[model samples]
Target: MQDQNSAVTLADAFNQATYIIGGHGSRKVKVLQEALEQVDGETFSDHYGNGSIIDEFQQEMAEVLGKEAAVFFPSGTMAQQIALRIWCDRADVKRVAYHPLAHLEIHEEDGLKELHHIESILLGEANRLITLEDVKSMKQEVACLLLELPQREIGGQLPAYEELESISAYCREHGIKLHLDGARLFEITPYYEKTPAEICRLFDSVYISFYKGIGGIAGAILAGDSDMMQESRVWKRRHGGDLIGLYPYILSSRYYYNERIGKMGRYYEQAKELASLFNACHGIRTIPERPVSNMFHVHFALAASEVEPLLVHMAQEYSTAITSYLNKTGGNSCSFEMSTGDRYDLVPQDKLRDALTWLDGEMKKKRF
Candidate 1:
C-alpha cells in the first residue's frame, strides 16, 4: 500500500505535472478559435444539411486518405457500425470477424449485435496484437473482417507491414471486404515507414477517430471509394449521424489534423525514453519491450485503483498528472501509461522525489 502521506503533486514539488498518456490537448487554440467563428447552429442540427462543416470535414479527410470520398459520423462506433453493416449488406452475410478486444467487440455495449443484427467472430488471443497468422488461422465465414491497428488491449502493439500485407492479401483472395478500425492509426505510421494512405489502401474501408490521436473534440470519418463512402453517407443519415450542423467537431478536427497530425513521431519517441525511466525503477516493467506507437503499459508494484487516485491527487497537490492507466487483472500489478511530457527530464528526480516523498507521507492516511 502507498502511504497516503507520501505522495506529492507537481505543483508542490516542481511546478509541473507529468502527463503519461493521451493526445496533446490545446497546443493550438487558435485553430479552434478559427472554427468557432462560424459555428452558429443547433447542437446537432440536420434540417437543411447545407454545407455542414461535417461535409467539409469529410472532404478534407477524403483527400488526406487519398480516397474518393469520406463521411463524417458523430462517433467511431457509428462510423464503424455502418462500415460493417454495409459490408454485411453487400455480401448478404451477417457476420464480421474481429479481434475479441477490438473496440467494436469489448466496448460499444453490444451495439453491433443489437443494432446491426450481425454476429462477431472474435479471432484473436487475449492481450496480444493479432498477427497474419492469427488471421490465417481463423476458420470463419463472414461478410467482412475488422482489425484494430495498434491493438489497444496490448498497449498499442501493431503487426508488421508484411503481416498486414499477408492478411489483406488473404482477405482479397477470398472476396472478403476489409474494414480497418483505425482509431489510432496515426501512431502506426512511425512503426512502419508508410503513409496513412498507403496503409489504409489495404482495407476496403477505413475509419479514423478525430479525437483520439488527432486531439479533436470528437468526430470520426469513414473513407473508401467514392461510391462506398457516398453510400455510407446514407447509412450515416439512417444512424442519426447526419447532423445538420457539427461545426465544433468539424473545426476542431481540422485544427487538430492540420496542426497536430505530425506530432505522433515526437510522442512515440518520448514514450520510448519514458519507458526507459520506468524500467529503471525498482518495481516497474513494460508490457511490451517496444511500444507500437505513442502508448505503452507500465506495470507497478501498486494496485491501479490505489495508484490512480493517488497519482491524480499527487499531480493536483504537487502537479504531476498521470494521464492513462490500467488496473491489474488477478494480480497486485498496476499498469500506468506515461506520455512524452513526463519523459522529458525537465524536473530533476531529486525535486520530484520531494513531492513523491510528500505523497508517501500522505498516502499513509488512506491505509486506515
Candidate 2:
C-alpha cells in the first residue's frame, strides 16, 4: 500500500518521472505552442469553418477517408452524434445500434438519446468486439449501425476485414446506414495492411479524431456523401460546434497529424512489443495478448490499491513510468490502458528491461 502521508500521488510521480511510456508525451501547453511555432498567424485570416485552413483540412481528410465530403467539429463526440443523428433522420428511423461499450452508449451521458431522441440497440457482449453474427442477429430495425474500428474500450480490438465487409454488405442490403466511429482509424490501418480509404470505403460515414493517435490539440472530421456532409454542417452549427476560429485546433491537428500519421505502423509494432514485455511479467497480462493497434489494456492480478503503490515506486525509483492509474476490475484484479506513441521510442531499452525485471520480482514476492 502507498504511504498515507506521501506527498506524491501516482499521477504526480508519473508526470514528474524522467521517462514516461504512453501516448505522444507530456500534453503540456508547449506541445501545442511548439506545433504552431512555424506558422505565421498574420499571413492567414481566420474564418468561420468556411475558409482555406478549415476547408482544406476537411477536404484532405475526406480524400484520406474516401468520402465525398467532410465536416470538421470541435470534438469527436459532437461529430459522431451528429453523424448518427443524420443517418437516423435520413432512414426515418430514430434508432441506432452499436457495441454496448461504445463511446455513444457509455461515454456520452445519453446525449444521443436526450438530444436526438434516438434509441440505441447494443449489439454484443460488453467484453468482446461486435461480431458480424451480432449484427445479423439484431431483432430490431435500426436507422444506422455504428462500428468503431479497433474498439477503444476493449483494448483496441478489431474485427477481421472480411467480417467488416460482410457487416457493411448486410447493412446496405437492408437500407441501414453504416457509420464508423473511427477515432483511431489511422492506428489500425497498418494492422489490417490497408490504407485509410480502403477501410473507410466499408462505411457510409466516417469520423476520425485528430487528437487520439494523431496527437493533435483537439478536433475531429466527419466525412460522408456530399449531401450528408451538407446536412452535418447545419447540424454542426446547431450544436454550436462552429466557432469563429478553430485554427488553433485545426492547424495543430494538421501539423501533428502529418508528423505522426506515418509513424502509426511503428507505434503498432511498439505496442505489440510492449504488450509482450507485460505478458512476460508475473501476474500481468495484456488484453488480446497481441495488439491489433497501438493500444492495449494491461491487467494486473492485484487490486488497484495494491498496484498503485508498486507503480509509484517503479516511476520514482526507475524513473520509467508505465501508467499513472489503475481501474479495479474485480476483487483481486485491476487494469489500465497503454497506448504506444513517441514517448515509447524515447525509453532506454535497458532501463525498461530492468524495470520489468524489478516488477516481476515484486509480483513474485506478492504471489500475484
Candidate 3:
C-alpha cells in the first residue's frame, strides 16, 4: 500500500560500500529521464527500430574514435565477436593473436570458437603483457590481433605506448588487422596522455563499452571504417544483439558520463594515497608498485577462513562494501575500483589503512 516513491534501496543500509565493480550510474541520466517525461518529448519515436539516432551516435563515436563509422550493440561481447568475425571474412583467415588474459581469450566463454569458429593464439604469460616481440615470434599468419587496453584481470596494467604502437605497426606491415577491446579505455587515457580517438587510430576496429566507464545500464559501441561497420550491423542482428528498446541504455549512459567524468581523476589520486598508507605492511603488497589508474589490487596473507568472513563482518560493521577473490596462494587478494559512489567520499586513506591493519591484527589474534 506504500507509495512507490517511498521504496528503500541497498544504499539505505550500507553507507561505506566500496563499489569495486558497479559503482554509481552517471549524472546525465536524470536529464534524459526528465526530457522523456515531457509532454511533447519523443523519447523512442525515431530510434525504436530503424532510426537516425543510431546513425548519429555511430558517426559521432567514429569521429571521436577516429574511425570511418561505428555500430552500437546491446553488448560488448557481440561487438567484439562480430568485429573478429568480420576480420576473418575480410582476411580469409581464422586465427587471432592476443594476450592470455585478454577478455576474448578468457572471459567470452569461447564465443569466438562456438559462434565465429575463430581460434586464438595466446600471446604471452598469465602474469605478463603480450609485446611486439611476442608478435614477431608468431608461427602462423593470424587473421587479426586482439588487444585489451588496461588488461583488467591482471590488475589494469597496460603496455608502454611505444610497445603498443610497435605491436600495431607490426600487424599493419604483416597485413593483419588489429582490433582493440577498449572496454576500460577511458580510464587508460590519462596514463597514455592521449585521447581515445588517438589510441584507436592505429587499429582497424575498436570496441568500447557503455557499462564500464559510462555507467549505462548495458550497451557497447563498435567503431571502424564505414564499410566495416556497415557490415557489422548485419552481423549484429544475426548475432541477436539488435535489442528492441535501447532507451534505458542510452539514457543512463548519457547521464553517467556527464556526472562521473569529474570523479575519475580523483579516483586515481586516492588510489595512490591509499597505496602510500599500506606502505611496509606485513604480508601486504600491491600487485604493481603503483596503481596505473583508479583501480588496483592488494595481495595479502591471512588464514583462509579469516579472508572472506573478516571482510564481510568488517564491511557490515563499518557500513562499507568490498569484494575479495581467492588466489593460488590459498590466501586472499582484494581489488579497489574507484568508480562511482559517495560511499567513499568520507572514507579516507587512513580509514582504509586502519581496515587493512585490523585484518592483520585479527589474523594474529586467532593465531592463524
Candidate 4:
C-alpha cells in the first residue's frame, strides 16, 4: 500500500483534469480580466486601511450584511479572532461558547487563547448541530457565542431558522454577544428564504470569507456596528493585517460577487439533485442525506488505497475529474466533500451520473 502522502499526491493529480467544479478553476486569463476590468480610477488602499478598493468593498459588504460598518482582513482567522477579542474585552468575561467543530476551535491553533488570553467553552456534540439547550446549559460566564452558518466541519449542517432565532434571543437576554462565522453565509441564504441582511440582523458581528464560495484569491470581511468596525481596524493594524494595497483581492471578490452571488440559489438546487443521484448508488452515501447548502460530503465504502487509483484511472479514461480528493475517514471508508458552482452546472447530469455509476461498479467488483 502507498503511504498517506502518496494519497494526497494522487488527489493533486485529479485537480489537473477537467472537472465539474471542486476548486475555483475557471480559465486563468478570464480571472485576470475579470479582476483588472473592475479597476476604474484608483487601485490602492491608503497607508493604514482606507480610501480605495478596500473601502469600496467594505461598504458594499456592510450594506449586504445590514451592518453599520465593515472592515476587511487578510484572512478569516485574523478577522474572527479579532472579533472575539473585542467582544471578550467589552464584557470582560474572556470566555466564549462555540461548537467543538468550529473552524476557530479546530483550525486556528488556539490563537484566541495564546494571543488574546481568551478561553472557549465548547458546546454541543462534535457531530451534531448546536441547539438552544446547549447554550442554556453553559455554566460559565461567556462573553460571546460564535455560530457557523451551514456548519462546515460536519457536512454543512444548519439549525432551523426558528432555533437560530431562539438562540439569538437567548444570547441577547443573557448579555452574551453573538458572532457569526459566516464564511459560507452566501451559500445558506437559499435555505433560509431570507436576505443576507435579514439573517445577519440576529448577530452582533458577522465575518465572511472572500475566497471560499465567492472565488476570490484571499481576504475576509468583518461587519458590525460602527464602533465595532472602528475597533476592528485598530486590531487589523496591530495584527499586521493592514496591507498597503488590497486591490487584487478586493477586485476579484467584487467581480465574483457580481457574477456568482445570484447563482448560489441555482447551485444549492443543483447540489440537492446531485445528492439524490449519489444516494441511489450502492457503496456510497451522502451526509445529512440532503444538502442544506451548496456543499455536502460523500462517503465511499472503500479504502483510499483502493479508491485513489480508480480516481486517477477515471480521470485519464474520461478526460474529466469527478472529485479532487478523498480523505481517510476510518477503517476502510473514505470521504470527500463537494461544493457546487459554475463548473458543476456545466456538466450534463447524465454524464455526471455515468461517472458515479462507474465508480460504484469498480467498488462492487472488490466486494466478492
Q: Which candidate comes out best when scored by TM-score?
A: 2
Kindly list the per-residue Cα lDDT of model 3 for residues 1-368, writing each as its tens digit: 11232232323323435432224433455645653453244545325335665666666777878888888788888899999999998989988888888888777899989988898899878787777888899999899988888777776778889998998889999999999999877777766878888899888899988767555567788998889888887887788777666655555555556566566666566656655544455555565557666566666565444455655554545445444333545535333333423334566645565666775666556544
Q: Candidate 4's residue-wise lDDT over 150-232, tens digit each?
A: 88888899999999999999999999999999999999999899999999999999999877778877788999999999999
In candidate 3 the C-alpha lDDT for residue 220 amounts to: 82
Query: What is the lDDT for 146 in model 1?
Result: 93
TM-score of 2: 0.97
lDDT of 2: 0.90
| Best-to-worst ranking by TM-score | 2, 4, 3, 1
Residue 190, candidate 3: alpha-carbon lDDT: 67
- Show model 1 residue runs off by greater than 4 Å: 1-22, 26-52, 305-318, 323-326, 338-368
Cα-lDDT of candidate 4: 0.84
lDDT of 1 at 219: 85
Off by over 4 Å in 3: 1-22, 25-41, 45-49, 324-343, 346-350, 363-368
> Which 10 consecutive residues of model 4 have the lowest summed lDDT?
1-10
Q: Rate residue 235 of model 1 by lDDT.
A: 82
The residue pairs that clash in candidate 3, if any, are 16-320, 17-321, 26-256, 28-255, 29-255
Total backbone clashes of candidate 4, pairs 3 or more residues apart or in separate chains:
0
Top-lDDT candidate index: 2
Model 2 backbone overlap count: 0
lDDT of 2 by residue, 4-123 (tens): 435678899999889998888777899799888999867474476788888898889999999999988999999999999888888898999999999998889999999999999998
**In terms of lDDT, which candidate is stronger, 3 or 4?**
4
Candidate with better TM-score, 2 vs 4: 2
